[model samples]
Every structure is written in C-alpha cells, then in structure tokens.
Target chain A: MNRLGLGGWAILVLAAIFFITPLVMTATFSFWEGGDRYGFDSYRILLHSPKLFESAWLSIQLSLASVLALLVLLVPAMIFMNLYAPRLRPVFEFMATLPFVVPAIALVAGLSALFTGPEWLIGTPFYLVVPYFFLGLPYAYRAIDVGLKSIDLDTLTEAGQSLGASLGQIIRLVVLPSLRSAMLGSALLTLAVVFGEFTFANVLLFHTYAVYINEIGQHDPTEAAALSVASFLLTWAAMLGVLVLGGGRRPAVGGR
Target chain B: MRSPLAVFFIVLFLAVNVLFMLAPTAMLAIQAVFDDDGAFTLEYFQALAQYQYASSFENSLILSLLSATVGVIAGGLIAFAVLKDDAPRWLRSVVTSFSAVAANFAGVPLAFSFIATLGTLGLLTKLLKTWGIDIYAAGFSLYSIGGLTLVYSYFQIPLMVIIFFPALEALRPSWREAAENLGASTWQYWRLVGLPVLAPSLLAAWILLFGSAFSAYGTAYALTSGNIALVTTEISAVLSGNVVSEPQIGAALSVGMIVVMVLVLLASNLLSARAARWSVKS
Candidate 1:
C-alpha cells in the first residue's frame, strides 16, 4: 500500500505499456479487417487450415516426446549424481549449459549440417528431437539438481534399503515423490522450450507448430498473428500452471 | 541377481547421449579448419575477412554491447524500485510477473508487434501523419539496426530485471541504513556500498545479455530478412540456401560464434565467483 509520487506512477505506467504494447498490437493486427472493422475471420482461417491442426498435433507430440525423454534420462542420472558423484555435479551442469550460450540458430545450423551431410540422420525425427533435448537439459538438470541439494538423498536411500527395497525401487518410490514439484517444474519448462522452438524445426523443414508460424508468415500475416497469439496463450498457460503447482509445495523432507 | 544386459543398456545410452551432444559441434569445428581442397588451411578465415562477415561480426559485437549496457542499467533501476524499496504492492507484483512473462516473449511475434506499432501503417505513424508530420520521411523506420536494438531492449529489460531481482534482494537493508545514519548521501551510499556488492551480478547479467543479443537470429532475421548482416543470420543464410555451398565456411562462422559466446561466459563465471567472494568478505 505504499504510495508513489506522480512521476513514479508515470514511470510504472510507461513500463507496463511498454511491456503490453507489442502483445496488444499483435492481437489487434490479427483481427484488423484492412480498414476500420474488426472480425474473427483470421482466427477462423487459422482453425480451418488442416495444416495448422496437423502441425499443432505434431508440435504437441514432439514437445511431449522431448519432455518424457528428459525425465527418463535426467531423473536417474540426477539421483545417482546426488547420491554418489556430488563433486562432479558442476562439470555436468557446465556441459548441460553450453547450448544456452550458443545461439539457437547457430546450434541448429551446426547440428543440421552434422546430421544432413556425412552423418545422414536428418531424414529421421531423432535429429530434430536431439536439439530439443539439449534445449531442455540445462533447465531440467538445474531444477532437479536444486531439488536434490535441498534433500537428504543418502538417508532416504538408506531408509528404503532397510525396507528391503531395490535401488530402482528406492529411486522410484522415495527419491521421485520427494522431488515431484521440482520434476514438474523442469518438465513444464522443457515442454515450453520444445513447443516454442522455431530455429531447428524451420531449418530442418519439420512441420512443427513453429514452422506453421513461419509458413503462415509467408502467405498470410493475419493467420500468422493468430498462431502467434495461440503460442503466447499456450506458453503463458503452461508457465502459470508450473508456478501454481510448484510454487507453494512444502520443502522436501530433510531440506535446508 | 545378474543383470549385465541392464548394465550394457545403461552404458550404451550414456555413450549415445554424449555422442548426440558432442559430435555436431566437433564436426563443425573440425570442418572449419579444413578447406574446399581437402587440405587444412585458414582459407575460411581468410574468406571471412574478405567477405562482409568481418563487419558483420563487428556490428554484432557493438550492437550487443550497446543493448546489454542499456538493458542492465534499465533493469537495475526497475529491480531496485521493486525489490529494495517500499514500492506499491500492486505495481511491484505486476512488474515482477510481467517481467517473467515478457522475458520469454520474443522472436518473430516481437518483431511483428514492433512493426505494427512503429511501421508506416502503424498506430503512431497514423497519429503523427494526422498532425502533419511524417515519421518515415523524418528518418524513423523500425527496420534498421538501431530500431532492432530498441525492439530488443523490450525483452532484454525484462530479462535483466528478472535475473537481477534475486541479487538485489540479497542486499542487506542494514548496510543502507548504516550509510544513512552516517549522513551519507544516496549517491555516496550507492557508489561505496551498493556498486561493489552488485557489480558481479550486474556483470554476469550483462554478459548473458550480450551473448543473447549476439546470437539472436530469429528477430533480426524476421525483421531485416538477412539484409542486415549479423554473424548468426549470415551463417544461417549460407547453410539454408547453399549460398556458400562450402560447409567449411558455415562451420567456421558457427565456430566463431561459439568461441565468442564461450569467452563471454567464462568471463561472466569468473566475475560471479569474484562477486561471491566479495559478498562473503563484506
């Protein structure tokens, strides 16, 4: 309830306008009827396009595939590292973060060349999925690593072992449940990155949703705007869902 | 009790994941040193020198530096207002949430929005024309490099704000109160106390912003259509259209970008470590 002077209020208003202006403009342009009238024809056209649905479905599939792959790969590795190789944690963390420093387009360009020529993996969906894996790795690893740092993995494992549980059973039953909120956060982030990724999909000519944006960008600006709006909404919703699910959870047992 | 098969599967998965991550970058770096004649040479680098690539590299560096500087300063002000001060609750929450969402909202949609707001047929353009002023004729188009920087700042500001918020929050209010009790002016407190404490995070944030701006291809490519020569867009254009047809030069450009980004990241890491030490000592 702190009060602000007129100038401070003006600055706040200006900042808000600056942040919202682009999104507002995109929405307005999506519905502009080439003159004064506004209509829902642009959205209708987008909905009617068969390619849009196919690409949207493909995008969902790819994003889910990447997230699932990350979870399967990262969770056990994280559990092992937390329990056995905490000293090497930083090395893995550094390696996972390299992709973020590299430009997405540059990474895709390098990756596409490696796969398309002499390597010959471009013909498969696996190559496209690989970069998404890299995209998801840093965030997933960081989230899980932070979660691991907060909990007593050794004690948890010992407790499970005393119960006559196998290592796999311990990980599945003990470690994962404690790390659910962190895992959910990582999965949601990975999903967001994979879903919105445009550079690789466009370069590789993958018919993902991002490519749908690029395609509609060429022939129909309005439809492209509609798709962009859809992307914004989806990304916002996923982020909000993550915050709601992950934000208020109690700290893992034995956490600092 | 015996599961060599499971062990073998685990080893194979690890090997394949490493290969997936490393092979592409390694292939490009190796190719960058080889030439069209199948001999190792600096010919690609030479070609880069002769082509517009050199200037493009310079342009990218300058633009990124400028954007990062401006972004950090703006972000610092906003973060300070929200975190360190007793700002209005509603305004603080709005900025915090908006900063998170806006930081991720970039690329083509960002470019398109800027164009719609500032283009010839844009809202401001129409408003200006009605007042007997032509913004375009006055040398104000949003497609140039400078205009692109302005557009980039929209997201970069939010990014810096979010990244620095934690660092700002970690500053103890007692230090500020100590300075105030000694009759120190605000500038004196900031100069002697705040700047040293915040220097590492600010530098780290700047380096991250620089790396982002340098490698940003989508917004620049969409806005300027590779017409404006950027290191990333140039490499993408060559690879996409077979313009170079020599993958070595394309790889060389990628290598160049990777090298620059790594150097910045390394420096930022060092700076952050130093900052951590400083914070502990203080």
Candidate 2:
C-alpha cells in the first residue's frame, strides 16, 4: 500500500518504456517474416543453423573451462587471504579490479601484441579460457570475498582442526559448502561473460556464440533478432540465477 | 592462521594473476613505446593525433560523458524513488532484480534490440513514420554517436541504480530527523546533508559508467559495423586490416585506453574512500 510518489511513478514509467520498447520490438521484428507475414520462420532458421549449434557448444565449453579455472584459482586464494594474509586484502582487491582497466578490446589488442606463445597455447579455442578467467576475476573475486566475509572462517577452521580434520578436508567440507552461494554467483557471472563475449573471440578468430550471432545478423536480420531475444533471455536467466541463488545480494555485473 | 599450505596457495595465486593480468598490460605499454628495431619510439603515440584516431577518442569521450551524465541523474532518481520510505518491498525486489539483469544486458544482443527498435524500416521507426515523425529524416540514425548514447544508457542507468542504491540506503533516517529538528526545510536538509553524503558515491558511479561505455566494443561494433570511429573498433580495424596491419598503432590506442582507464580507476578509488568515510560517519 506504500506510495512511490508522482515523480517516482513517472520515472518508473519512462524507464519501463525506454527499457521494454527495444526488447518488445526486437521480439516483434523477429516474428515478422516481412510484409504481413508472421510465423516461426526466423526461429526455425536460427534453430536449423549448424553454426549456431557449433558456436553455442564452443561457448558453453569455454564457459565451463573458465569457471573451473576461476574457481580453482580464486577459492583457495580467498580462503588464504581471509585466514592468513588479511593485510594483502587491498592488493588482491586491486588486482581483481585490474581487469576493469583492461577491457576486452584492450586486452585482446595487448594479447595479440604479446602473442608469441607456443601454438598449442594460442592456437586452440581453449586458450581463450585464460582471458575469460581474467575477465571473470573482478566480479568472481568480489562475490567470493563477500561470501568469505559473511562466514565466521576462523571459528570454522579451528573447529575443524580440533576435530582432526586436514586443511584440505577443512576447506572441502567446512568452507566450500558454506560458500556455495558465492561460488554459484561467480559461476553465473563467468557464464554470462563467456556467452556474451565477442571481442576476444572475434579478434582471436574463434567463432563463439556471439560471433555467430553477429555473422547471422549480417545475412539475416530477422534471424539475428530472434537470436538476440534468446541471448537476452539467457542473460536474464543467468542474472536471475545469481539473485535467487545468492539470497538477494547485489550481483556484480556490468563493465565491458 | 599462517599455515604453510596457505602460504603456498597465496604464492601460487599471485604468480597466476601476475602472469595473466599484469604481463599483457606491460607488454602493451612496451609495444606502444618501442619499434621493430626494439628501440624506444613515439611514432605510434604521435599517430594518435591523426584525424581518425583523435576523432575516435573525442567521440568516445563525448559518448561516455553524455551517457554517464544521463545515467547518473535518471538512475540516481530511480534509486531514490525505490528507496523512499513509502516504497513497497515488491517494488524494491523487482527493481533490484531487473537492475541486475539490465546491467548485464549489453554487447551484441543490446545492439540488435536497438536496431530492431530504431533502424530504417524498424518497428518503431515505421510506427513513428505513420504518425508523421520520420526520425531518420530528423537525422536520428541509430548508427551515430547520439544513437549509441541512447543505447549505452540502457545498461548504464541500471548499473547506476545497482551501484548507488546501497549508498543511498546507507543514509540513516535519523540524520534527516536531525536536520529537520534544526529548522531546515526538506530542500535545505537534502542540499546540506543528503547531497554532501551522496556526492562521492555519485561521482564514483559516474566514472564507472564512463569507463564501461568508453571501453565497450561489441555493441558499437554490431550496431554500426565499425562505421563509427570508436577507439575500440579502431583497434580492431588496425589489427584486422589486410592491407596495413599496424599492431604497434593498435598498441598505442590500447595504451591510451589504459591510461584513461587508470585515471578512472584512481578517481574511483579516491571517491570510494570518501564514500566509505561518509558511510562510516552515517
């Protein structure tokens, strides 16, 4: 029964118009198979495109790899930071935010400049997991940091130690289970990044789902619009996943 | 607290991050300042003065500034409205969740959505034309920087709401009562108490939005197909140009971007410190 005031209602209405028009229009435009015709033609075309399947598969693989790499590198490091080297919190934080400075465009350019690696490292699409991991670092680290801060780590570790648990067991059994929401949040973020990523995949000559959509867009606007709707829904789902799973914490999103 | 295992993991973490994160940045700086002979040079930096590169930087600055300003004002208001005492819980939950999704709703899909809404023969374009308002004839092409500003603000506005809402919420209700008790009117209380406390967070959020817009590539690339001279697209052009692939010049532009980002980062850090102090006081 609370009121948002006249100004609030107006602002909200304007925001809704601004935000929803494009999405609604995109969906409408996708269904229009040109001039009084409307059917599932665009969706059919997109669904039948092998390129769509291939690239989507690749993006999913890359997302999994990136999330795995990110979790492996960050979870233990965060635990270590919280327990032992709290003084280095600022340094780690600074490092995490470093990716914000080097956006994907700049990172890819710098990456190409520094691309003297062995072919095995830079040749395959799997190498992209490296930069993807870097891209996810800032948001992922913050999510994990928030999780770590919320839990009583010292007490948990001491209790585990008194119960004759190994450090590995303590981390696996005592810490990570409590940090599930944080891990899920970071994983969802990495998923969003990998799925929506285009600059690196395009420049690096890998055809990700995004790059495929861009290609399809050039030849078929309607089909591309259809794919765009799907992509938007995917992003919404991932973000919603964070909200639902993170227990209403503000998910670290945006930038790049 | 200082276990050997923890030390080992910390060192490993540092090594992995430094090698992946810092090395590329260092390599970029080196490439920007050095030549094929491996000697120091400034030719690439000088190349940034050329019309294409200079204009891209100018265009980017203008676009980012425009979007960030609009985003902050509108988004700040939206946050304020959502956080008002009379606002309902459902409104807060919906706005928070939508902001989370909308903030991440950028890149190619965003570009496609905008195009479908505003491009020639687009749904809205056709709809408006029937009402006697030809936007394209009004020179409102979705391919221009102005068009990009409108699109960029979609994500930027939501991002502002997400980042600034917490700071706004941190304002204690008692503070307003304290100001009102001193005979200050609502406007006076906000001018003296609310605005001062919110300034740092607002500035920091603005800078963050600017950085986000400035470095964005996929949206502009997909929207204009690199027709617009954004620094990001320009870097892509320089690297992918078959006739004249100047990786050095690309490095120069990337370095310029890094410089601007570093400045934004430093300003953000300082502002965050100020905001933190304000939050602590409140």
Candidate 3:
C-alpha cells in the first residue's frame, strides 16, 4: 500500500512550524507586561476600550450594508441575463471579474484623486460600502454564477410563466429561493473583505476595524496583538461560513 | 425579444458599475496625465522616475518576485505531500480548509502576528536572546524587505496550496504507473510526464502569487509603518496629503500598479486556461 514516507511527514512538520509559530508567539506576546512579566492586562484593557467595540460595530455594519448592496445589484441583473440576454454572458462575466485587476490601494488612490464630492461623503464610514461592494463583486459573482449554472433557470422561469406569473414574480417566487445558499456564500465573502479591508479605510480616514487596529498598534503592541487575534478569528469564521455553506467552489480571495 | 424588465435590469447593472467601478479607474488614469487646471500633462509620469518613486516600484517588484518564488516551491511541496495516497482524508480536508483560512488571513492581523513573533521585544526574539543568538545583531529586522517576505509567505504559501492542490489532484496516478511500466525511473517519469503537465498551473500560480504580494497594502503598511519604500505605501502617503500633497503623482503610481496587475492577472488567466485544457484532456 502507498504510504507517506519520511519526506512527506517532514514537509507537514515544517508547514506546521511555519504556520503555527507566528500565531503561538503572537498569542503569548499579547500577554506580555513590561520586561519579562506576562498577564492578560493587554486583552483586559482592549476589552475595556470603547473604541474597540465602536470600530467593530462599524465594521459589522459596513459588512452587512455591502453584502445587501452586492446582492441587490447582482441578483436581479444576473437573473435577467440568464433569462433573456444569455448571449451577453461573456461580456457580463468580463465586467464582473475585472475587479481582480484593481487593487484596494489603487482603488482608494483613484477615488481620492477623483473625489470632488461633498466633504461629508468622504467624512463618514458608510461611503465605504461603495468600494466594498466593488471589491466583493468578483467573489460574489463567482459564487452566484456557480449557483446559476447549477439550477434549471429556464425551466423554472417557464413553469412560473405558464402559471400566469409575471417576470418579476418568477424571479421572486421561483429563482430567488434557489439562490439563497449562493447569496449567503457571497455575503460571507463580502463580510470578510469589509472586515479586513484597511487601505481604503485608512487612506479615506474612515477608522473601520482594521484601521482601528493600525491606530492601536502604533503605541500599544500588546493590545494590538490581542486585537490581531480577534481579527484572525473573524476571518476564519467568515471563511468557514463560506466553506460550510457550499457557496464558494474555489477558495475566496480577500481584500487586504 | 428582450423583456422590458430584463432590459431595465441590464441597464441598471451597467450604469452602476460604470459610475462606481469604471469611473474611479478612468479618473485615476485621467489625473495621472492631467494637471490641476484640467489640462493634459505628463509631469507626473516623469516624476515616477524620481528616486523615491522609482525605488518603491523596484522594491515592490523584487518583493513580489522573491515571495512568489518562495511560495511556489514550498507550497508545491506541501501540496504534493498532502495529496499523497497515504495521506488520510481528514488530513487532506484539514489542510485544504486551513489553507482557505490562512490564505485570507492576511493584512493587519497578519502584520501584528509577525511583529509579536519577530520584533525586538517579541516572544521568539526574547527566547532566542536567552540562548545567546541575537537575530538583531545578525542584521535581521522584521521591518525590512526580507522580514516582509517571511511574513508574506504566511499567506502566499497557503494561497499556493489552495490553488495548486486541485491541479495536483488532477494528476492521475495511472499516468505515473504507466510511466513506471515503461521502465522509467521515478525521477525520469516525473521529468518526462509530471512536470510538463504541471508547468502551466505552476506558472499561473506563481504569477497570481506575485500579483497578490504586489497589490498588498495593509500588511506592508502595518509592519513597516511607511518606513519601507513600496508603491502602495507611497500611494497612500500622497493621498493622505502629509507626505507630498501631490495627488497626480499618487494617481500615476496607482495607475502604474494597475497596469502591472492587469498584465500579471491576464497572463495568469491565460496560463490557467491552458492548464484547464490539459486537465480536461487528461
């Protein structure tokens, strides 16, 4: 029988070391108190900090808003294309995937260069939903596309049409129900992006959760480390959500 | 005969994307060659040849190239090991899932993790000091290019594993068995049969990794605190209006980055498509 010999085990061990060491050290260092003393004082202070919850709440809200925006924008258009303009699939697919070429930093820079909007527009955090929606499109489109590919879209539409249902009714009553898992997966992917995105928040001066971490990190490394642990867990939770929900066929790429 | 509703929906999608997605990008390109008076100019593009801007571009390229190479080799090895016939199903699933999380577990938290592991007062640094091995004295700084490479490998390697695993999985065992029956040695079998099939996927993965590392902003910003010369940090610095207050230069830098990324991604897509063709044929 085939067996993983010495070389295979060795590679796995090295991977474990490489992957686990930073996490282990970071968790341990989060408890460091001055010289050699160790305690949970950093995390305690972190938990007590008002800004932590405020930033976290803002990030969560942004994530929800972005996901909602993504679904509303993508779902109807995707359904319409599938039902009527199927020939436009290639063009639509190209547009949906083009976001991959636009990095977050570049997008922020571009927006800043072009932004002649009102001061309040750049002043608030909610404006981030726009860029987050853009960043989320490629991933969400992929997930939704996979779902649309699997379902019998034409059959469902025809059945609803024969039942005297209107086009909008067919979408709402028949197709939307089948795409629930896909939408959820896309939402989770978008949630991960909004939660972890820093460049736009930082450059635009929005002070979202990742930007908040950068702020705390400047003076308090321990507290920042504690926050770092939380952020890592947050990403893990969202990624796991995507996997378990079977929304993303391929591993999703996140915003940096 | 497109329904009125479908036509409306399609138009709505196009309008939103053009206004939001395409507008900013087009504006960036426009600003790069345009002055404050809305007159066309190439001053900003010329300014990219300056030392600070030029070096940042050079550093970003070198960093991406180095990190991608390291990720490809290490991740390829790990993928091969994990996909071996003897590896348990649970182990495969665990590695696959871990790669998914780790690949996305980048940016600020990742920077903090590296700092806590390698910084002057970091856990491992202190431990190693007690053993009389001073990494700092040996000219190792976690804020430097080398340090960022190591930190980047954390995500890059996992990303490679995630992307490369499926390609490796498609490499059927029957091909290897056939090669062996044809009196080929293991190394010869791999050289003649395995590497050729995998070459395109490996190249595609490498380029994607390069693009990921090149486009990265948050992790580099957090770890280096803008100390390092990187296109991303440079773009952010200018946009922040504290470094130079030159929006045109920032636009140019970002446009340059966009061009590089577009080229890299296009190449990767082409190679991946070729790889997919082979996979299907096999």
**Residue by residue across A1-256, what tens digits does model 2's lDDT show?**
2247898889988988888899999999999988899999999877787889999999999999999999888889889988888899988988898899997888887777777688999999998998898889988888888777767888878888999998889888878877788898889888987888988898888999999988888888888899989988999899888888877543232112
**Model 1 error, position A103 (Å):** 2.6
TM-score of each: 0.93, 0.95, 0.95
The TM-score of candidate 1 is 0.93
Better of 1 and 2 by lDDT: 2
Clashes of each: 0, 0, 0
Q: In model 1, what lDDT does residue B83 have?
A: 55
Q: Which prediction has the highest DockQ against the true structure?
A: 3
lDDT of 2 by residue, B1-282 (tens): 468878888888889778777888888899988889988999999999999899999999999999999999999999988888787779888998888888888888888888889988789999999999999999898989889999999999999999988888888888888887888888888899989999998999999999999999989989877677988988888877732747899999999999999999999999889988867643
- CA shift at B26, candidate 1, in angstroms? 1.0
Better of 1 and 3 by TM-score: 3
Model 3: lDDT of residue A181: 79
Using Cα atoms, each model's DockQ against the true complex is 0.46, 0.63, 0.69
* Per-residue alpha-carbon lDDT of candidate 3 for residues A55-126, written as tens digits (9 for 90 to 100): 889999999999989988888899889888889899788878767788888888777767768877776789
TM-score of 2: 0.95
What clash pairs does model 1 have?
Answer: none
